[model samples]
Target: MPAPEGFAYVVRGADVVISHHGRPVTTLRGRRAAAFLDDVEREDPQELMARLTGNYRRGNERQARNHPRNRGR
Candidate 1:
């Protein structure tokens, strides 16, 4: 959904960087790197980071469970 406001990223070498308002928000890598990027582009920032980085935010629990795609298969 046009990415979250101020949310943008780039996959460089092996790292997937998530940024907001030109500031670095977080970096994701490993086998699920691409998956994380998809999350960044699709899910809300709160839900995406919560699921990928374990950084939770209030009121986002529901968003996490109802994420766009909940399966890794």
Candidate 2:
């Protein structure tokens, strides 16, 4: 498939380039390059954030609910 509007990709002699929202983020080389590129483009921001931060934005409700700082005056 073609790259999305805000994204771009290129297939050099033996490498695959990948970008996100238009910024270059990764490059894959060798036989599995295409698969790697596919995976990169299909990544989910929410899943990534949850993996990195231990909680997704929607899952932060508990903290906001119990924190006095977030309480309405």
Candidate 3:
């Protein structure tokens, strides 16, 4: 199927990254790729990527705050 307008994808080795207007929105590989393929048109790609990637970003923020470099102010 043709990509949605303003949305595009590129394959980097084993992974395919879906981007919106030059910003990488999400990555697809293995099961995630298969699962998202069915809902590509039905869902908001930006919202979906945010929901998925947001979790990791939150964790990284927590880890950074707890790191030794951040200790003692």
lDDT at residue 9 of model 3 (Cα atoms) = 65
Model 3's lDDT to the true fold?
0.64
Q: Which lDDT tens digits does candidate 2 get at residues 1-73?
A: 2212434456787886655555666666785675654665688533432333233245567788879987773
For model 3, how does the per-residue alpha-carbon lDDT over 7-57 read when each residue is reduced to its tens digit? 666767667687766888778898777666566568976455555544223
Q: Which stretches of candidate 3 lie over 4 Å from their true place?
A: 1-14, 18-26, 55-73
| Superposition TM-score, candidate 2 onto the true structure | 0.37
lDDT to native, each model:
0.63, 0.54, 0.64
Steric collisions counted per model: 0, 0, 0
Model 1: pairs clashing at backbone N, Cα or C within 3 Å: none
Report the candidate with higher TM-score, 1 versus 3.
1
Candidate 1 per-residue lDDT, tens place, 22-66, comes to 778778788677777666577675556545544444566667777
Q: After superposition, how far is residue 58 of candidate 1 from its true place, in Å?
A: 4.3
Per-prediction TM-score, please? Answer: 0.47, 0.37, 0.41
Clashes of 3: 0
Off by more than 4 A, model 2:
1-5, 36-73
For model 2, the run of ten residues with the poorest summed lDDT? 48-57
